[model samples]
Target: MAKKDDRGREGEERAARYLEERGYRVWDRNWRCPQGEIDIVADDGRDLVMVEVKTRRTDRFGHPFSAVDRRKRERLWRLAHAWMRAHPGAARGRSVRIDLIGITGERPATAVLEHLEDLR
Candidate 1:
């Protein structure tokens, strides 16, 4: 895979581990459809979380989370709805939330991870 793709996958994995460590059960990774893609789909106790994972080797331009602009957020929202429509049971009881996971650094061991929940 391309270097950037590799970095992104690594970041997603790290984000998943971080959430799992905090008790989130990850249900899917890299879920894609015609609308868009969700980096991670997880259950955080009482909510179904749709996560966007952004990874950067350095923040020269901006923090990784900065990449998740309003347009991207809109696309994510649509994707979340698409996911719910496809998997109705996943949203039966729990609330749906959008989350952002930003990772900055070259390696997982030293990467800085920041998770922002309920983005919308």
Candidate 2:
């Protein structure tokens, strides 16, 4: 695989570990269904979170989270709706939240992680 692709996978893994450690139950990674890919799907018991993970090796370009723009938010919203519809019980009366996981570094140990909740 390409170096950038590998870096992204590593970032996602780190984010997953961090979320799990915080008592969040991860439902899926790279969950896709025509709408788009949700890097991570998790539940913090009270709500369902659709996570968009932006991983970068450096911040020279910009902060990783900056990559998730308005268009991306729209797609995430659609995907979240589809997910809830398919698993109605999972999201019954529960709020839905969009999150951004910003990761920067070439390796997990050197990475910086930032979690932006309720992005939508």
By lDDT, the best candidate is: 1
What would the per-residue lDDT of candidate 2 be over residues 1-73, giving only the tens digit for each residue?
A: 8988888888888888888999999998988897778889999888899888888878999999888889888
Q: Model 2, stretches more than 4 Å misplaced?
A: none
TM-score for all models, in order of appearance: 0.96, 0.95
Model 2 poorest 10 in a row by lDDT: 103-112
Tens digits of lDDT, candidate 1, 1-120: 799989998999999999999999999998989887899999999999999999999999999888988999999999999999989988997789999999999885469999999996
Number of backbone-clashing residue pairs for each candidate, in the order shown: 0, 0
State in Å the error of residue 4, model 2. Answer: 1.3
lDDT of each: 0.91, 0.87
